[model samples]
Target: MNNAPQPHHHLSSDEIDLFELFHAIWKRKKWLIGCTLFAGLLGVGYAYLAPQVYQVSSVLRPAAINELDALNRSEVYKLPPVDALAKVGARLESYEARLSFFRANPALFEAFQRPGQSLEQSFEAFNKNAINLTFPDPKNVDALNGAIRLEMQYPKGVDGVAILNGFVDYAIKLEREQVSADLKVIVNNRLNEIKGKIDAARANYETDKQSKIARLLEADKLKRAQLEDELSAVRLQMKVERSNRLVELAEAISIAKSIGIKSPTTPSALGAAASRGSSQVMRTEVNNQKIPLYFMGTDVLEAERTALEQRTNDDFTDGRVAEIRKELRMLDVNREVEVLKSRSKEDIFLRDVEPLWAEEARLRGLDIDMSGLKLVTIDRMAQTPLSPIKPFKAIIIGLSLVAGLMLGALIALIGHFVQARRENGPFPMPDRHLPHPQKHTH
Candidate 1:
């Protein structure tokens, strides 16, 4: 009979022995408990030793339409609440703005300093993850509300609330100053434009006035020349009439000397002498012819001729010459042109001046002080948090215990395999199912 140990028919190579596997694990129960306790203690120590981080956040919303009414009415700047919120969001996210805030307030970030890190390096670390900005989703229905959230995370002993509030105020103030500067520039540019128009209008008015004066002066000169010509013609006519009178007197003197008349005689006197002898006979002849010039005595004719030859000034003799001279004196200066040239207030006389001045006054009167302007409304202000946000004790302990249990189980399995290999052969049969080695009775 063959006495070698025979393998059990019920047990197969693929089948695992549950009793033996449990027995092996049970043998190393002390190790599993020790590892679990050690891992739990480590978790507890880490939970207690890590720095506690606190979070503070604030909510901001767009201002109401009425809040921006003054700015819109001024027409200098038209900013809507949505755009204002966007600007605030931009400022909140700017790295430079954050750095500026950090520099401005040194006490708030003093806790971030480390031993070997420079101030700038510490700030860089803080700036990397400390500030968080959240904006409303555009795809959502409430996007028109234009709400934004600002969050700050800092280690223990840091004043995140004050820093956030101060940064918000600073951003708004900076935006207000920028708006004011832009408004001032626009207003000044408009004022300059109005001034230029006013100046151009005044210049045009002055030129027109000068042209009017020149025209008046030219007309005055023409009138004076006409009067002078009339005066000269009248003087020449008087001189020629005087010479004709002299000739007539000389002819009349010769005729009187030949006819032997010695005194001035009228035509009526000659007619009466011829009709004096025929009063009753009534045989008189009617003659319409005037008496000849020789009938006047030479003494009167000679006296008139002497006066004509001696007259030097014809202006005194003729009324027309005196009138012409008076007119020429009147035309020497234009009163209308003088009045225009001597005017002191030329603006009143200018056309389209009222509108320009009115616009200028309106621009000058605009309110550029936007300090009181409401850019954003703080829905919620940041407050000190009650608890820290890091190092969850329960979760850490639970996960560490689970990991330790797994490691202990792997070690027990490895030890069990090595003992089994040493006790039996390299390929050991199932411990429980293998028949005991029968005594070999030969």
Candidate 2:
């Protein structure tokens, strides 16, 4: 006989009582109401205890056309666009920069009531209510403007008006310093470049002048050497010519004596010149006397020799050679340096400083005008805010009521199930001590 237990149609106590869900909630109505009221009271108390924050704010607009035009009329140079100032402000107030700002300005947290808290916590709290810069939505294409609005919460015990003014002052100070530093850099760079040009020009002039002088000196030296060589040759030629003339005069006298010509001039002057040697003969001419051909030739040669010696001496004593040496000695290598040094650096800087001067004045004027606008004009100066922005009372109460009702309902259902399980007998136990039960058959 096949022994198999038939599947029993059954419902366990653990099964969800779908039809009785409403009745279960209705039975626990008192508990749900009690939980809802308690949660609502807690919400109201939180709203009462939260600290209130008050905001101080200001607004800025681009420089108007009239303002810029007025400044232009007064100055030769034009002022920079207003958007530049706006961009700097935006950069200073960006998310990353804001973080640094809070850390830097600890006084922004001086209002906190919590004692013994780390400055780290104070800085964190200040960040929560830190300064903000808002711009028009990018989506509103036509509405986009250069106007910026600044807002920050007032700290306890510190004057809100003073803080707002301080921030504006700091921003303007920052812009001015940046402009000054930029101008200084530009001016310094330009001056350095000019100095470099001057140095280069002076160097080039010196090099060229030195090279020319060197060449001139070399040429002069070569010419002087040549003159010395020519003078030596001239002296040698003069000596040979003097020897030949003496030999010719001696032969002519011998011939004259053989021909029986007797003259006092020939025997006395000519014989004396021949016997004493030509070196001793100083007279260039014999005056007022009838002379022989040999004597005449001797006089002519003496004159020629004297003239050659005078010419050679004159060449060495020439004024033009002295002039060349004088010019070389007086070469002024520092002419350009002296001229350039006469002009000071301040003079040069002032000469080119017109534009930078104008720019600085323009920025200063703009800053002054901005200050007249009450430092960007307060948008909504902080008043003592009577109410806090956080822990919205109405919202908290509503949420708490709903949450309590739901939680209470779940607990009530779970309790109901648990009680039912307790009243019912223990679930059929599977005994590990006995062998597995065969399929039960009637």
Best by lDDT: 1
Clashing residue pairs found in predicted model 2: none
Off by over 4 Å in 1: 1-11, 14-23, 114-119, 139-141, 252-300, 317-319, 429-442
Taking all chains together, the TM-score of candidate 1 against the true structure is 0.83
Measured against the true structure, the TM-scores of the candidates, in listed sequence, are: 0.83, 0.49
Q: Report clashes for each candidate as comma-separated counts.
A: 0, 0
In terms of TM-score, the best-performing candidate is 1
What would the per-residue lDDT of candidate 1 be over residues 237-283, giving only the tens digit for each residue?
Answer: 98888788788889998988776666886666546757785564433
Give the whole-model CA lDDT for all candidates, comma-separated. Answer: 0.83, 0.56
Candidate 2's C-alpha lDDT?
A: 0.56
- In model 2, the Cα lDDT at residue 418 comes to 71
